[model samples]
Target: MALLMPASLLMVSATTSADAADAPQNTTNARQAKAKGKAKLVAMPQIVQQGKKPASAGSAKAALTATIKPAKAGRPVALQVQKGKKWKTVSKTKLTKKGLAEFGAPISKGGKALTYRVTAAPYKGAKAVTSKPTTTERWLTASFSDDFTGSTLSPSWSNRGIYYEPDSLRECSKGDPSAVSVSGGTVKLSVIKDPTRANERCVAKKDGKSTGSFDYRLNGHIGTEGSVSMRYGFAAARIKTHKLRGQHGGFWMRPTTAGGGDPRAEIDVVEYFGDKHPQGGLTSFIYSTKNNKAVKTGSWIKSPTSFLKNKKDGWSKNYHVFSVEWTPKMYVFRIDGKETYRTKVGVSDQFQFPILSLLSSDYEISQMPGGDKKLPQTMNVDWVRLWQA
Candidate 1:
């Protein structure tokens, strides 16, 4: 219409046009502000359980995990512990690419129950958020513990496979007391050339067929067979593995009574095949009887390098605690208090005892050509502790 509007009407019409022109920008700004505020609302950090319920105090360590809203990665998260009436920040870590943060809850001595929480710090345009408090189960004293401060292996331990000789699996290796020793507050387990068979060369075999030749070796194999056994508990060892590829270092458990109508099970808490090996060489598995036939569960730990402290920290380079939390429902495997794997299959309810060994098997000796030159590959155990459930 060509007719001009009144002054007052013109002003109103102009204001309407201006408001319409600003609507999209204003709405966008509101959305941005709302999103920034919402980003502060992080999900409560959850305790990663070693069993059906939240991890108890008896575990080597507790893991707390949480996610940030709006997928903010690389943000800092702090773990806090409640003491008396105050909360103390104990540890801090940055979030991963997927907006995840996992904190290893610091445990105190004497097995006392503790409360914990996590907090995300204010960053960029987002505000801070704190998780709700969670209390851990009562810390239980270890039922069995060995610091290896003595000059001899504890009476609680007995040599394993001492009389065993070259077998199909271990073509040229056997257990010998000489391969295990206690001193310097640690137990040293070694794969060494058998003294009596130092000059002997053993033919390595695979599937009962000769594959190659290697020197005779003795392993540090010991167990708490009749001395210590538990139905369900947490078993842990502070150990540093051997650095070579020819041998295996194991912290495992087997039923105290085997080969009857009992539930037969083998819990391999942790196994290492030395450094730089393909497939990472770290595994946690269970072998159990199903329908009167053997069934295996678990596998090589995935992304094993993620368990290490740094690029220079190999499994053999530094001492780490390898542990298993055995419950009637499942088995949770951990390295240095960080869970590596868990499974519900092949859970053992029978009384099982712990075993430690550094062994050479024929099937793997071939991978370490001329490996005998690196004889006496030793694994060190700082201590072993068990908390029975």
Candidate 2:
């Protein structure tokens, strides 16, 4: 202390003191810069709009998602719709852990077009941000619709696979008029024991080899093959699927032409394989030909229960709207207006018609414990509608 220190050590001590004196100011400047920075909001490129019938009041909604830069979790985001010249908030939600906000808004009104945007209020240190406005396309009245109000199948639908010709996939089942009935504003599609072959058994074969023998069953299969078809648009049906794993309940579409070559794609909007199936058995897929070879897209839906109304609800317990939006670029599948899956592969450009069926294939018959005792599994269809682009 009293003695003089070395010149080099003295210089080092002075420098250390200076740095300590300036540290607080440096941190203050950095904090000010961050507090002045503005957050950025980006919205999805396309907003899908759905058409709803008079009976489906709240089902006609669209999904909108946006991301906030710098990732501020729990930040508030508002979805706004353009009302006249000003924007009105329609939905409000908090940002997810990934700084993303999603909103489902009841914005579709018959054939009218609507515009929407997202806004994030100023947060702890970031400035307010707004997303670019997105205008939805006009959704006109559905070109094809059946409410199933009549006591019989409409002229629009025809029975399918009435004859029992064995196929590699469905070796034990065939369609019959008795398996389809219309009443009470709904069409009942059932998989029942074939009365004509009540005492006979059907052998399921693959590649000319018999795999197993099953009870002869008749399926409920019907389609609008000749009466209604669309090139690209939205198709939807409200259905309560069959309750057992032995049969497959499907809301699907196929090209009007018979051949299964290029440009002929099969679009399965939704398929359910019963409640107890280990895989949840909910699927959406497409089959198409590419380079003269078969190609398939999509798979079983993950977290299928997330689409249900509650823990007590199931595909067979309540009716859910299954829909597919087809465009030139891709197909988007949805359950109850919420997207389940999407794919750009195997996009069909040909006119496609909708088909509804509850099929009992020989391969799946073993899944049902009681065999023919669980024979008559019925799927109910409340209605079907199509909006052409």
Candidate 3:
């Protein structure tokens, strides 16, 4: 099971300081949380999206989360709302390990609409960030999890395939609709010889393949881009892979803008090439541009097996839970809900989406032990789940 290690390493540290000016500071509408200062807010009143649930009784499913920019470690924040030009505090909580906060119904259901915002008072060396007013009943529609239960792909997913640029990002692979399929309560991603474009020329060139080389392969890739993009949340997937060479399977994320810059960059949650890889088969990474140079972190998690349930339950043989906690200042990666790697290098500050793929590159073709004989290897995902930070 496995994935992305760029050709060259960026010379930046993962725990470097990040500035508020580095992220998108725009506030959106009534459907989502509106921030006036430096914090990102989202409120979910139910486990699943509903018109509005009774707030008076209190709910275990109801939740409120905030992501603050220029994060202050362990800072206390007041969640408030304006009433007759007066912003009254509803409740207070301190930030988590990554400058994030989550609380249940700050104001118990009162049968009245309350517009809420988070207030982070100025602290030692940390400037204040005040959020805009957004109502409890009118919060962003919380996204539900996809368990891959049906025989077809869910509408939440879009086929993002046919990798044209033969750069390090895509290698020499293309996305074919047929390459991705859902069955038996699981999603399957495969890499197979392209029967349709067997002799068709490729569009881009890697060192090993040029435009004149015939199109020979297709990969399975599906992502949530236009249809639905999640902001900060915990994304987890239970996956099992094959120990094949020449390709890798991965789960990653990116903002809707698709640009390579600070706070709106790529998040490689997990990538596994195969079993017993030189770098130990699993890696987590982040990518963005800082100081006109790329900023990257997260690597082959040094103790991947420490989180495994047992020796027989390795990645290629069984499904394991891989998750990432996205707070304001950094990302914390984990397997089976236990921590693995944490970094502040490139954290996306806005709406981003999830992706799944099994890709190959012409540069790695020589590593396949069975060559084309092992053409249709696959990655099986038991389910995909998400919850706000």
Give the TM-score of each candidate. 0.77, 0.77, 0.60
In Å, residue 355's CA in model 3 sits off its true spot by 0.4
Off by over 4 Å in 2: 1-75, 82-88, 94-104, 107-115, 122-127, 132-137, 205-212, 258-264
In angstroms, the error of model 2 at 91 is: 3.0
Q: How many backbone clashes does candidate 3 have?
A: 13
Q: Write the per-residue lDDT of candidate 1 for residues 25-89, one digit (tens) a residue.
A: 57765454555322111111112222211122344455445555444677787878888899999
Shift in Å, residue 204, candidate 2: 3.7
Error of 2 at 105 (Å): 3.8
List clashing residue pairs in candidate 1.
none
List residue ranges in candidate 1 displaced over 4 A: 1-76, 95-100, 109-113, 120-130, 165-168, 258-263
Candidate 3 lands at a TM-score of 0.60
Error of 3 at 52 (Å): 38
Model 3 alpha-carbon drift over 4 Å, by segment: 1-142, 168-171, 199-215, 258-264
Q: Alpha carbon lDDT of residue 329, candidate 3?
A: 72
